[model samples]
Target: MNSHLPTEKQQKLKQLIVIFCILLITLLFAFTLLIAEPTQELSSFELDQQGQKVGSGPTEFRIHNQQLYVAVPSNGHYVIPEADLKTIRMLSDDIATRQIAVDQKHVYCGNMILKNLNPQTVRSIGDGYISDGQVSYYCSQITERNTELNVVQEVWQILLHHTGIGSKPQSYWYPHYQLETSQSPYQLTVQGTVSNGEYTYFRGKLVEQANGHTMRYLPSYSGSSDRLRESSHYTADGTHVYYKNQRVPVQDHPQLMVFDFGGGIESEFLHDRKTQNFYYQTSPFSQKYSPYHLLNKDDEHAHDPLFLSQQGIYFYHRQEQKLQRTGDNPFSQKLTQLAPDVFHNGQDTYYLGLYDKYIRSGRGTKLCYRSTVLYRLKNAPVNRWQKIAEVKYGNSRWRAATIWKNGAQYYYFDEFGQGQGFDQAVYLIKDAYALRFILNPSRSSDDIRQYAGRGILLSPQVERLAKAKYDENFCVSELWSQNE
Candidate 1:
């Protein structure tokens, strides 16, 4: 029995040794497999609309809301749609599509793939504006293909100037509805006025010699007019001065003052207090006129350019070289040319003027008044001036009439309405959509009768002028908005 027990124990030991060797061999093989190749779970994308998998080989796809978004190598150039496997859109074959940027309405083709932009660094600034650091892309609303507006170049940095009071003014660049949303909370109205550190741009055209660092808006008494193209805006840098991007020359910046007669007539006349020089449309008048001495020097009306004196009435206008004389002063008191050709005589007001209506093709819209000029005559009788109608509203009363006459022909007031007190030229309620009309005084017709009755007349000439093809500069000038 002892011999049998020893033999069994030896067999058991041999069996244990064999089992240990097998286990060691298995562990060694597993360690070798782990070191040779690492295990990672790779993502896979579905087929595109064309039934072909997009992007180059070994590409990893990103799935967002069941949509397949993939970042491909520089050599891959296809955009895939996950909703429908057969709706693939192919970019230019030569383009190396790099990245995919997904917005609600657009999936961007990395920068270099379209319009020579760099995809690696493309980013959105604000208000549908995107940039690759150098070039700008201005999208009106959605940022889809064929909807981008390439603005300027060499834009490493963008500076938005807010003309509004609170945080900033609302941006006119984007749609009005998106202005206050969380996505776009900045109040910034570019209005074709933007600046970098080196240059200032208006409507994408650079203002030459204007320092962008110092460029700021020159605010008028009535803010900005609704006319985007022809508003009376000014900006100045360290040494240069610009009025709506046009250079304005003045000896001293402090001495230059803008004298506007209200009613859309803004920055038309500039006066230099240091030199006593008057500028019309930024051009110096040939002569200067000094104020006349009055019994009451303290009276504000006595300091006007046109004041009554013992030597008759002296008038100043852009058409004359000197202060033109208006014969003898008929009125006993000092006369103030309240509204261009309209004058007040303390008790009754009189207008002795002529009509010269001009239109700027595409500029009369909401918040912007009409454009017209009224020229006052030298020697005219006050008795011929007659009233046509009276407009009364909100504790205000205004009289409209034919303030001048040539003979049997009576020239009546056309547009007579609100201004500081009242503008004898522009009617606040009338919208003329850039049309022209003429009244023939020689022929006593319906036009003249309408002119005499309601001070409003329409002619077929309006349609003709509207159809007439005029250049962008047809009636464009610094004096373009002459609503006297």
Candidate 2:
């Protein structure tokens, strides 16, 4: 073997090297093409199960059973079932009334009588039915009740039907029954008198089996005072008699007084049924310095002292309690100052509404509002706060606030500034769980929009939309998907 290669061998080696280089370049180009393609790209259109191209938008798109549905802003609703193109027939120009209901047996639609006849024909009822619209169908006398019709009118009532034997009225009517219970099996005779006064002893039989009974007592005092008072007692089936201005906490004692707190009850007297711990407020009538001065700077009165957790009874006291001096008063406290309207969601989490601002708390952590922000508390002990959303309050003003569901959802009412005050509209953002809002737009300048909207929870089965990662600065407009 010679150290130097021949000319022919060198040429062959050069050709092989060129071929290997070309192959390597081809593989590299193919790999680059795969990586360059965007993983998150906006789909132009989608196809149905029947290969039909559905329209596209930001919303999550899906096709089920060859049908296409779209999600959009329909009267404040984000998602709606798409109308069937085949069943879009105009049966009649005149609109017909239809009633809808669902039961274990079948889904009912159309008029009450017609729905009863053919209960199974009802399909998915759309939201459009709520508007002034019409539906049509062929009439059929499915039962004998349809053939016979009679109408009558009575004073203070309108009788819609009368069939010689019975009658039906437009308004509701409850039948009354008065049965003599003296002859019944369950009967008892008892005699009793008041301990304080020597009142007259009346003889009366207690009917145990009767549905109910009313007793009218006219106790005439023979003494000097000219004042006369009459008290009547009503017993249901000779048991559980309710007396005026008195409540019986337990049964078997007809004459007993239950615990009653007179006027000035504390504001934080919350009854925790789950833990059986009764949280209440104590009166500040005896204390020289008002609790108001300790908690609130304003002249407003602090009626009741609230007990927080296992900590001793907390009141706005200047010298007695160290927590109060440490700015733990209800008004001056940083937590309450950040959120005046506090809502505890029966769990560790709490929603705070500090004047116009909003915040959330849990364990030992607190988070405040900056813009349209959402905050969540970190896990216990070493609790911390985290930001969720910087949503924009599009066309609404803050009204009231509420925290519910162990801090799962923080809801707030937004005054739509429609001159209707607090009843104008409500805006709700489902924190990081689901980004959504409920809007009730006013019909006119003077009309008020009350509870007329609901936030929708996007489910995969119902709406196969792409899930977005939690973004603290996401807006309502950004969360809304219009695809499919």
Candidate 3:
């Protein structure tokens, strides 16, 4: 035991070694804490459907209950889109007012209302470009198209000026793409790959793949262009696929089946029909919808392109995104298009949604209504329209033969009758789902006629369009976290 004892220097060296070891360990642990990012909580990555981290990179994003915040490379900040949320890039802050209107519906732009304007009757001979008796509204501005004087080759939002087809078709603004075009849209062949003269255009711009000799624009899969194929949706060269205006690398296998959302001008829901893959401007895999379509079209389960699937008559939900199954859609069966967003369903005429002020499609509760009496218009300004019988909602037992309109018609359907027996009826109008009927003006106004129109009195004020209310059946994000 006495020999085992170390010398004075040996004892000092041993103590130094022990202390060095402790300090090394402490330094290593401190360095690890610094490098590992003590603040990181696994939320730096965009989450998958299972709430698991999917991918991580320098890209910035914010995940919250109501929004999927993403960093805009241009602005370098995460911001929420105005409405569609899908096409955040193309949409301006005021794009909320860029809506498609049904007949007799008001056109709201920002804070102003373009009264007496009808989009379906534009002289441009297209659904969007209409010339109503009220006023003319082109895509961008209140410009007029001389369809009688010139033939429109294409109509794009970007194309400001055109030389007309009668003029030399060499260099003119293509109306469809809204892009200046040396090649006519009518001559650009079915495949977006067609090169006129030497250049090819897509998405209101030129295709970089255009080599003047071989500009490819056909899918390797089996299909032809639909009537709406003029827009640059899923176009492929022999090598790569282009979606929305960018190149989809060969690995993505875009040939499977292309699904487009909204329209050619505003394509937000670009996805694969087979794989249910979704895409955005920066990330190829932005979101996903359900893989299968249960209801054909009217069946409602999975037929709409905007990612809105019907669970019931009104209950709608998005398969993988933030939007959940919202209950209630008034219109059922094969809905006919009386105007852009207005549908003529079996016997009811209902507003498509609540966001007329905003251009969103799949949100807001719809109005479902029915009237027994009807008269198909014989000499009405617009053809093929049948006005339904009006029903009042206020403190009156007589619910039929009158509608709520502004200072123009004979009767006012007291729309918001609280505890007035017609509370349910009033709720429909108060909720912006009022079913209004028209009076047969040619008929007589007798004093004894109480159920019938006594005279053409000025219309009374009705309820205003309701604010957008999207009541979800079940929130997926909240449910997922709770289960975890």
Q: For candidate 1, lDDT tens digit of each residue in 1-484? A: 7879989999999999999997786576555555554322123333333233334432223434345444333222222352232332222121222232433333344321234345445454443344555654433331122223233211101111111111211111221111111222221234435455444554334577766565655433321223222225555565766766677776336545554433243324455557655554545544433333221111111112333345554444433333445344544574654333455454444433222234544657222222222223333344445443333223333323232332333333333432222323322122232111222223223332243234343211110000101122334342555333
Evaluate model 3: give its lDDT: 0.32
Highest-lDDT candidate: 1
> Candidate 1, which ten residues in sequence have the lowest lDDT sum?
460-469
TM-score of 1: 0.34
Select the stronger candidate by lDDT from 1 and 2. 1
Poorly placed runs, candidate 2 (over 4 Å): 1-165, 169-349, 352-484
lDDT order of candidates, best first? Answer: 1, 3, 2
Q: Note the Cα lDDT for every prediction shown.
A: 0.37, 0.26, 0.32
TM-score of 3: 0.25
Tell me the spans in candidate 3 whose CA falls farther than 4 Å from its real position: 1-227, 249-265, 280-289, 292-352, 356-484
